[model samples]
Target: MSKKKKPSVLIYTDGACSGNPGPGGWAALLSWNGKEKEISGGEPDTTNNRMEMRAIIEALKALTRPCRVEIRSDSALIINAFKQNWVGSWIKRGWKKSNKKPVENQDLWKEMLKAMKPHDVTWTKVKGHADDERNNHVDGLAVEASKQYQ
Candidate 1:
């Protein structure tokens, strides 16, 4: 008898901001092998960037096995950080930004990296509200969550 390989996972995430420094929320949808899981949370006072990072972290944490992950997000901060190799710089330098300040959302970033260590992830940037169904749905969920929690 041999163990069957786990299915690959796809995740879409969106983070909402009521105000730049106001209420914020994050939403994520995880899908694998015909199963879907939606997760979300909000902070009474926060920024969209943090929520965006949190969404990715949460989605990665929810996986049951090491698998391929496709993560979609509309957040430039989160997308750029990965796409631009900024996280690598931060990690290479002990998680400090260019100015030696602790990277914003370091806790979540650390967790995300750890969660991702056992798997492979590919990040895709989706334009918000531009007919990207999964991203839009997650965005709506984040918005609703922010409104409810604020």
Candidate 2:
């Protein structure tokens, strides 16, 4: 007999910032086995990219077990990093880009890497504020959360 595989979870994440370096927010929607959970939070001062990265980090952290995960995000930096092997390359180069510059979000990337270590995750890129309903919903949640910190 073979063990049944658990259902894969789907997560949609988004981030917003009141200003480039001002109050920011991140939101994530996790769906599994016909159930869904939404989470959002804000920071007093941050950047949109950080919030974007945080959304994925938090969603991965929320998982209670080692399961398959599919992450959809609007940030090119996040999606491309995984899809294009940017993270692996960065790690090989000691967290420095090809230009010999330090990676901008090394801390968050490290956290995300740790969170991802035990799970199987596939990343998908979605256009922000576009036709995707789930992405749009999370975008709204992030914007609202950002206002609380502004």
Instruction: Score each candidate by Cα lDDT.
Output: 0.87, 0.95
Candidate 2 residue lDDT tens string, 1-150: 999685699999999999889999999999998999999998999999999999999999999988899999999998999999999999999999999999998999999999999889999999988899999999999999999998
Model 2 per-residue lDDT at 17: 97
Report RMSD (Å) for each prediction in the order shown. Answer: 2.0, 1.0
Q: Weakest 10 consecutive residues, lDDT, candidate 2?
A: 3-12
Candidate 1 lDDT tens digits, 19-130: 9889999899998889899999999998888888888888888887788898888888777888898999999999999999989888888877898897888888889899
lDDT of 1 at 133: 87
Which pairs of residues collide in candidate 1?
none
